[model samples]
Target: MKTWKIIVLAAIVVVIDQITKFIVVSTMQIQQQIVVIPNFFSLFFIRNTGAAFSLFEGAQWFFYLTTVIALCLFVYFIKEIGDLNIWTGIGLGMAVGGMFGNFIDRLLFGSVVDFFKFVFGGYNFAIFNVADIGLTVGIGLVVIGLIVSEMKKKKTVAE
Candidate 1:
C-alpha cells in the first residue's frame, strides 16, 4: 500500500478513537454505565493507569517507557511496509493509530480512557475503548497474516 494511504487509514483510526473517548469523557462520569443491551453490553467510563487488562496498575512510568519502545518499533518497521500485503498494511495502520491514541492519553492524563463493556455468564470482559479495540483487532490481523505467510512458505517448500 502507498504511504499516503497508510497515513489516511491510520489517521481515521486515531480520529475515531479520540472522538469516541472525547464523547465519553464529556458526557459520562467515572464508572458511569449506560446500558445499550441489558445483561450483555454497556458503555462505562473509567481510566486505566496500567497496561492492557489493567495489568501493573498505577505504574504509569512503566507504560510510558513501553509505549515509547512500541512507538519506536512502529517507526522502524514502517519502512518495510511497502512490501507488505493490504491486510498487513491495515493491521499496521490500526496498531500505530491505536498506540498513539492511548499514548496521547497517557502522556496528557496519566491514564487511558475506557468505556465499552461486555458481560456474559457472570464474567465481565475487560472494559476497553476504541483504541483498545483497534489495537486488539490490528494485532490479531497481524498474527493471522504471519500464520498465513508461514503456511504458504511451508507449502512452497514442500512443493
Candidate 2:
C-alpha cells in the first residue's frame, strides 16, 4: 500500500474516533450509564487517567513521553519499510490513528473519555472507546500479517 493511502486511512480512523468521543462527552455525564443490551453491554461514561485497564493511574507525564516515543518509532518504521503490504499498512495506519485519538484527549482533557462497556457472564470487561478498538484490531492484523509473511518465506526456502 502507498504511504499516502495509509495516512488517509489513519485520518479516517481518527475522525471517527474523535466524533464518537465528542458525542459521548456531550450527551453523558461522568459515571453515567445508558444500558443498550441489558446485562451485556452499555454506554458508560468515565475518564481514564491511565493506560489500559486503568494501569498507572494519574501518570500523565509517563504517557506523554511514551506516546511521543511510540509516534517517532512509527514514523521511522514506515519510512524504513516503504511500500508496505495491504494488511500491514492498514494495521499500522489504524494503530497510529488510535494512538493519536487518545493522545488528543489526554492533551485536551488530561484523560481519555471512555464509554463502551461490556459484561459477559458476570465478568465486567474494561471500559474502552473507539480508539482502543482501532489499536487492538490494528495490532491483531499486524501480527497476523507478519505471521503469514513469515510462513510464506519459510515455505519458499523449503521448496
Q: List lDDT for all candidates, in order.
A: 0.84, 0.91
Evaluated at residue 114, the lDDT of candidate 1 is: 94
Tens digit of per-residue lDDT, candidate 2, span 1-159: 788987898899999999999999999999999999999999999999998899999999998999899889878988998877778888888988999999999999999999999999999999999999988888887778778778888999999
Clashing pairs in 1: none
Using TM-score as the measure, the top candidate is 2
lDDT (tens digit, per residue) of candidate 1 on 12-111: 8889999999999999999999999999999999999987679999998887888789878866776764566666677777887888888889988999
Query: TM-scores of the models, in the given order?
Result: 0.91, 0.96
Off by over 4 Å in 2: none
> Model 2's lDDT to the true fold?
0.91
Model 1 lDDT-worst window of ten: 80-89
